[model samples]
Target: MTLVSQSNEESTCERPTSKYAQYTGVLAATLAAFSIGTYLSWTSSALPLYNKNDTLSVSDQEGSWISSLVPLGAIPITIPAGMLADKFGRKRTIWAITVPLFLCWYIIAFAQSKIWIFLGRFVAGAACGAASVVVPMFTSEIAEQSIRGLLGTIFQLQITAGILFAYATAFTDNLHVIAILCSVAPALLLISFPFVPESPAWLVMQGRKNEANDVLKHFRGAHYRTETELTRLELQASEMREAKASIFDLRKYQKAICITLGLMIFQQLSGVNTLIFYAKKIFDDAGSTLSSSTSSVIVGAVQVVATYCSTILIERAGRKLLLFISVSVMATCMFTLSGYFHFQNSHDLSSVSWIPLLSFAVFIVIFSIGFGPIPWLMVGELFTNNVKSAASAATAICNWTLAFLVTKCFQDMVDLMGISSSFATFGVISLIGTVFVSTVVPETKGRSVEEIQIELYGTQISSIPRETDPEV
Candidate 1:
């Protein structure tokens, strides 16, 4: 199938009258991500309360389960969530996410037993998993190509904001109160998101061309050329439909699948989550002047700020450049941290106690800019409509599974190999990730879906631009 030429399309279309509608819809949909962030990080604060036997007594083993269950719960629902997004539409699947999110908080707020707590964490994880797939898809579809990167990055920004919100609220130390507060994110989404338009791309895919035209007008503003945009979407949808792709057809999408999965693999193996999961312990072990709680808060704040910076820079610096810089600097910080730990094992480290905290803060900042958000953003950018859902599901599963494995094994690696060696290993992996980004990952900045698909498939659509060097 032929694709529309970007230059011709742009020449035909008028500038959007306003971007406020797109911004508002993204804000509304990403509330689910905000809710997921609170759930993912909730254990950092709530697990301590559980262990204290104040509200409900939880054994150390049970606390571990409660903390890990979110990713574990995410695994089972991710594929199904992707399927639902493709079948019912991204907005509907996102709306369905509220059920588990609400149930999660309700169960946690009223729980009298550890089983109830476990169930609560699991369902919260399910919602997190589902949102991971649907939110990016929804945002990507509704966004104009010019600002898609900025909008896609907002998903990660909301997640970081939610994490910081959870960290900030830990001072309350009231499990029920925190649960109730976290529930407000989803509650707001439930109230506001219904007013937002369904994805025009999905509407086009479903052959609802008139509705897609109307929705495009809503997102792009009345002055925008809805017919031109709709025609492009129609061609893409028809091509994908004629391909009739299934899970078995994924072999045809190996390049995208591999690129996406590789990014997810490197994202987890870079040890960002290891640092997040064990931040307090790492801070305490290093004997930082700042309290572990204070350090955790500072790190969370940095993450939010840095991810916000990513949204600003992504459209400017481009994805591959950011990934390369992010991983390279992250590798340096990891090695620096490893040296500190190695020295600590042998020498008094009071004078350089600041090194660990500094290293962690810098590592988190760099990570938030590149490895943390780009992987997810690309999940929405890299694939065609036919295989996008499967690819996203596979990417989410890879990410969560690696997250669980890394988090679970990190302590064991520290015990067996020493903290120094464990961090150095992560450093080596991150160093390798830099090479991967430079060699394999393509830059998606300022590219449309058809342009990206042409690069991935090596199909020469006469109307579409040919792939060029990322540097160019």
Candidate 2:
């Protein structure tokens, strides 16, 4: 039956079973990631000696290295995780993803040496890499087209929320306690996620048609293979599985691959993570009367509230409009921050220190709403079946690599050019990103993966319009 017939004739349809079941997996993914996100983003600000000692002291880079190394590990792990997700079911992939992280947490919590700290950081980072690629792809495949943006964006939305909650948790817990708390999160995957169904798309790829049918039935609460549309999804999955996607396979889809990489890199350049991890230092240098810890808390709170705002608007306003608005807002914040810091450089630090805190608050809020959530959705929607696996791997590399640079280099950059120059540089980058988004970004809101594939990578290899973005 067609969607028209099923919708019009079925009164007892009782809604799709997966409508609710879908959240089971995403909620699990979100909880695991949110816990990680909070711990990763806030711990730098919350680390006991950070504010107690000047960053110039260099006595405790080991603690900061723990947070920075997480993003660095994503570079090497993304490609392999994507491949594993393809080989095993998403469920099985997730099953193995967090095992090493469990051990990493215990080490990180108690390690005294820099080497041991880096070891834990690298391992936990690998676990998150697997989860990031698999969970979003899984969410995209299972979600209905109507609410896809909402569901997809929710992962990122919660990540920002996670940053806030993690920062707040710092008020009470020390590093060891935080590590223990963060370590326990992945245990949920061990206990609760097994009861959830595997991604039906993965089942189709394995030629397990009978299993796919049963899984679909469990999710949709209806008999499987009722429509050709549903069967087409299965066939698409089967066709792609046969394609033998690999690192070299990605080069064939160069333009789409570039777009994916650009999406990830642009996300980092927006200064969202920089603002989160370094907000305390930014505020301290700007001469905020508020203590660094208090200022950091304010910044985290702003991000959480703004991310929630994005969650509300994503489905209604659509992806393009929101990204445009978000980038514009971010640019505004960056400029404001630059101006504040520039003024501080010329005047006494105490006279205008409050300016940086206010501007940083604005920056975090703008970042939380648009740039924060849109990039993940863009990447999730950009590629066709042939290239998504490879593209996601490449994109994950771009995500982690740039994140590492920002995380690892923020302190060095501050030392070299001063905070005023750092904020100025980021402000300029945000404006440049606004231009990139205007030119290349496609409107993926409500489009199916197949439709988005055609939109982004058609026969003649045309590109999306720069002015097609919402703000332009």
Per-residue lDDT for 458 in model 1? Answer: 71
Residue-level lDDT of model 2, residues 426-452, one tens digit each, is: 778877777877888778888876676
Score candidate 1 by TM-score against the native.
0.84
How far in Å is the alpha carbon of 89 misplaced in model 2? 1.7
Steric clashes per prediction: 0, 4
Provide the lowest-lDDT 10-residue window in model 2: 459-468
Per-residue accuracy of model 1 over 220-335 as CA lDDT, tens digit each: 88868777778888898888777655566566667878888898988899888777766766776788888776887898999999988877787688999999999999999999
Q: Using alpha carbons, what is the TM-score of model 2?
A: 0.83
Instruction: Write down the lDDT of every candidate, Cα atoms only.
Output: 0.82, 0.69
Model 1 C-alpha RMSD vs. true structure (Å) is 6.3
Pairs in clash, predicted candidate 1: none
